[model samples]
Target: MTVPPDDPAIRAQGLVRSFGPVQAVRGVSLEVRRGEIFGLVGPDGAGKTTIMRMLAGVLRPDAGEIDLGGIDVVAEPERARAELSYMPQRFGLYEDLTVGENIFFYGELFRVPHAQRRARSGQLLEAAGLAPFRRRLAGQLSGGMKQKLGLVCALIHTPRVLLLDEPTTGVDPVSRREFWAILYDLRDSGVTILLSTAYMDEAERCSRLALLHAGLVRTCDTPSGLKRAMAGALVAVVAGDPRAVHAALAGAPGVLGRLLMGDRVHVRVDDSDRRVPELRALLAGRGIADAAFTAIEPGIEDVFVALLGPEEAA
Candidate 1:
């Protein structure tokens, strides 16, 4: 399960793609190290799926260079695709097929040997906790279980790279955690995973992640790195009138971003020590003298809004 030195599992440079006058991806570039879980995080319509499809060789980019496992994904897709397994948002599993049959079908399609398929299917089922449901039909399974079967089918051939697009959306929190555990296990076994997710919490679990928005990468780094890169301090203001507090501070100097959470309003500013006095004065002017304030740690959502402003993250 050891990874090769100095060789990235996947690399894309200056990728650009457009569809019917709408630009989906705009000069996006990224690299995924061997045996690391790299996350592409963004809200919907952020071009995460488009970039993934290009890397998976399912779609051609209008312009870019892509390489996977040392093979040029754009120039030699067939050879590059041999070392990858991609499970998109909606996997095409036959409703009538049992879990065992579904795995068998995928194994056959991949040209896996009968003995190897049998062994692999058994191992995957046991590892995924699906050994008891081998006889159950695919459509009858829960959303999380269906996702597990898809992963099993994808892993049956033992590819070097795994590409997943928004894998945990709509899944229950418990299932999402379980799926992430499985991903970590695969990473420990030397499988490089590149998955896209809209959830900021899930993005924090990756070894490194790129934040994409409006077809561009706003930032790319480890969760801590991204948090540290935020150019401000977060102040939580507990007030009886959060809406008024937010409105009052919305256009204040040095204010980066603001969020209203129940009775509290979190504001990001360039310098809380320098501005809290002025902020207090402003609140007092507005007849808001009872508000309590405390500096707080910045979350991913805060960083995004601080970097892109509230209009963009929304």
Candidate 2:
């Protein structure tokens, strides 16, 4: 079931939260339509976790409103939480309990009736490739397997919305891919997922994203929409001396900014059509003429740097 245009599955308006002197989230507002994978993409200390906590009803917002499937989450946290699942970076799993026991424990916590719990647990474990390890203790599982089990436990109640905080961080590449595949399946089954992630590539997999920085939102849009909103042309330059190239292009006319990526530099200019030749001339003038120049599609990292004026794109 697609989200109705008029009623979003998750809505936060003018949300604010603080820790003593530091304001973690400052009046952030966002909406997640049902069945969409909405991403909270940001670097460390970007208030992603704070916002997620508020949405999960674990932290009370000092001000503003939070609604989950039309329930007032900020006021009636328990009621709202019943319709959502929250899987944090480090999920609380009983190390000594078998996978099946852990699933049943969470099922009991959510008050899922025994019969439904058995069926749902079986289905989730199978979908997560953990059916064979039903008797394995949680601590004996691989990091990926533990995470998968955590997801299964969180999903025991089959809530309408799922909130995940940096779910793929520190996971192996293959495990990360597998976890994302599971997410796709959930979204296809009409579960609205709101997840926070620092990885740019992971952010790309979302239907839409809110780019956060230092307790403020830099921008929010679809990956392509964010890139398209970037106000200039991008060019990639590979040079023998990338430092020298950066120094030459720093503050150059028609150049907006430049970022170093390995031995190459991504330069954004007001108009590459008119400025690339000049850039080439400048590189040659600096006693480096063999630099390769190519126009490339703007990646999210490039768009982030352009929008935020910083290079924290990881």
Candidate 3:
């Protein structure tokens, strides 16, 4: 079911949270539509986790309003929590218990009836690829399998909203793909998912994304929309000495900035058509005559790097 345009499944206005002297989440506002995959993308220490915790009712917000399905999360946490499921970065699971046992425990805790738990657990195990491993101890499972089990436990009651904080951090590429496939299936089945991710490719899969930096949202929009909003043209320059190339083009006219991507440097310029030849000439003048340059379309990663600035320096 599509979300009502006026009614968001999850809504936050002026959300703020602090940890001792650190303002972890600062005046953040967001709205998540029903059945939509909304991604919170940022690096570590960007307060993504803090925001998720507050929304999940695990931590109280210092200030602001949190509404989940029209229930005020901050004012009525238990009621709000009844409609939400949270899978933290390090979701706790009883490692010694069998997969079936783990699911049963979580379902019971959520107050699912015995008969309903039996039926729901079976479906969740199959969906998470844990049906065959039902008899296996959770501790004996692989890293990916363990994560899948955690997800099944978190979803046993079939919550309307799913909050995942960096769920696929260290999983293999294949497992990550499978996990996302399951998430998309859940979304299609009318479950609103709010996930935080460090992976840019994963963020691209979301219907919408919020880019956070230094406890503030830098931008929020569809992935394509954000890419289209990049302020400068991206030109890829291949040079023998990328450092030297960057140094030479650092202060060149029309050049906004440059980033080194392995063997090549991505130069952001105000006018690519006017700057390419000038950049090539500048590199040649620096005795790096073999440098080749070509203007290319800016991507989400390019925009992210540009907005967040250089990681080492920033």
Supply candidate 1's per-residue lDDT for 147.
Answer: 90
lDDT of 1 by residue, 87-125 (tens): 998866887999999999989888889999999899889
TM values, all candidates: 0.93, 0.95, 0.94
In candidate 3, what are the lDDT values of residues 104-181, reduced to their tens digit? 898988998889888988887888888999999999998888888888988888899999999998899888888988
State how far residue 178 of model 2 sits from its true place (Å): 0.9
Best prediction by lDDT: 2
Error of 2 at 275 (Å): 1.4
Q: How should the candidates be ordered by TM-score, best one leading?
A: 2, 3, 1
- TM-score result, candidate 3: 0.94
lDDT (0-100) at residue 202 of candidate 3?
A: 91
Best model number under TM-score:
2
Error of 3 at 314 (Å): 6.5
TM-score head-to-head 1 vs 2, winner: 2
lDDT at position 13, candidate 3: 89
Model 1 sits at a Cα RMSD from the real structure of 2.2
Which residue pairs of candidate 1 clash? Answer: none
